[model samples]
Target: MSADRATTETAGLMDRMYRHQRHIYDASRKFYLLGRDQLIAELDPPPAGSILEIGCGTGRNLIKLARTYPDTQCYGLDVSAEMLATAGRSVARSGLSERIHLAQADATCFDAAALFGRDGFDRIVISYALSMIPPWRGVIAQALRTLTATGSLHIVDFGDQRGLPASFRVLLNRWLTLFHVTPRHDLPEAIAELSRIEGAESRTRRLLRGYAIHAVATRRAA
Candidate 1:
């Protein structure tokens, strides 16, 4: 499918999926959305820097990052209005409405300069959002293109259940399928290809039996 069509489709899916789920999103998602805190803990944005989160659902990670690095400006973009509504409220409740900027845009093709008045960010993070996105690899490339020369991008998402028992893997995958989440088994290879093209470096770890936390894709200096 074309990028525009894919974006429309995904936006529709998200709108439908989260229209009601947004009300209880944070409450229910906290239980299974692992690796987010770890991603925040590991983010070390430069002093008085800028950070952006692609697929920043509910503004959760950006809120945490703003609190953790109060001096750094934070930005977020997502395709779903339903999700952004909750995100806006969350940012306000955290009293970070001024510190963080949220936008409704497709992660794969958004113009960072147009969205946030800049072409690059010091740090970029993507939580467990890639699995549900059909053009996620394009999102990674767009994200890399928007990174400062020395900035890094971090991503944590569902992984192949390579470490789990067959029965458990079957059950888990089935349950996740109900939510339209697919554990990308080829993620490491995708990252490797991206590294070669963008001169970025990546490291990934399997958590909870092959669920993955991938981080710190640093762009090479010019």
Candidate 2:
């Protein structure tokens, strides 16, 4: 399927599933959404710069980021209106409505310029979101394109569980599959290829025996 068509379909499915679930999304996702704090720690945003987050469900990360980097402007985009609605409420409650911007847009092929009235972001993050996205690779590519000259992209998602017990891995995979989340088995290779194409510096590390965190690829300033 074409990129646009795939985006449409995925958005439709997410909207259907999250229409009601968004109310309790942040409360429920805390259990299994691992490595998010680590990703946030590595965010190191520049002072007075702009940050964007794709697939930002419920704006949990954005809240933390906004609190951490009060000097930076934060933006989050998601494909589901249900998710954005919750995000909106979170931003309002946190009183970060001015610093953080939330929008409903396809992460894979969204036009940042059109959506945000800007061309690029200084830092972009994708945290454990790739697994639920069907065209995740395209999302990464689009993120790269949306980066400023000195911008960086950060990602954290499920790993291959290479170090975890066989039984645990089996059960975890089974549970994640029910939510349409699949650990991309070839994530390392994919990140390597992305770095090569962008001619950007990349670093990857396995955390917790690859049961949770995988690799972090960064394209340093050119």
Q: What does candidate 1's lDDT look like per residue over 104-125, in tens digits?
A: 9999899988888988999999
**Superposing all C-alpha atoms, what RMSD in Å does each candidate have to the true structure?**
1.3, 1.4
- Cα deviation of 55 in candidate 2 (Å)? 0.1
For candidate 2, the C-alpha RMSD (Å) to the true structure equals: 1.4
TM-score of each: 0.95, 0.95
lDDT by residue (tens digit), candidate 2, 1-222: 786777778888998988988887778888888888888887888889998999999999999999988899999999888788888998999999999998888887788888898899988999889898877898888888788888888888888788999999999999988888999877778877886787666667777889665455566755
Candidate 2, clashing residue pairs?
none
**On a 0 to 100 scale, what is the lDDT of residue 105 in model 1?**
93
Once model 1 is optimally superposed onto the true structure by TM-score, how far is the C-alpha of residue 33 displaced, in angstroms?
Answer: 1.4
Q: For residue 49, what is the lDDT in candidate 1?
A: 94
Highest-scoring model, lDDT: 1
Model 1 local distance difference test score: 0.87
In model 2, which regions exceed 4 Å deviation?
A: none
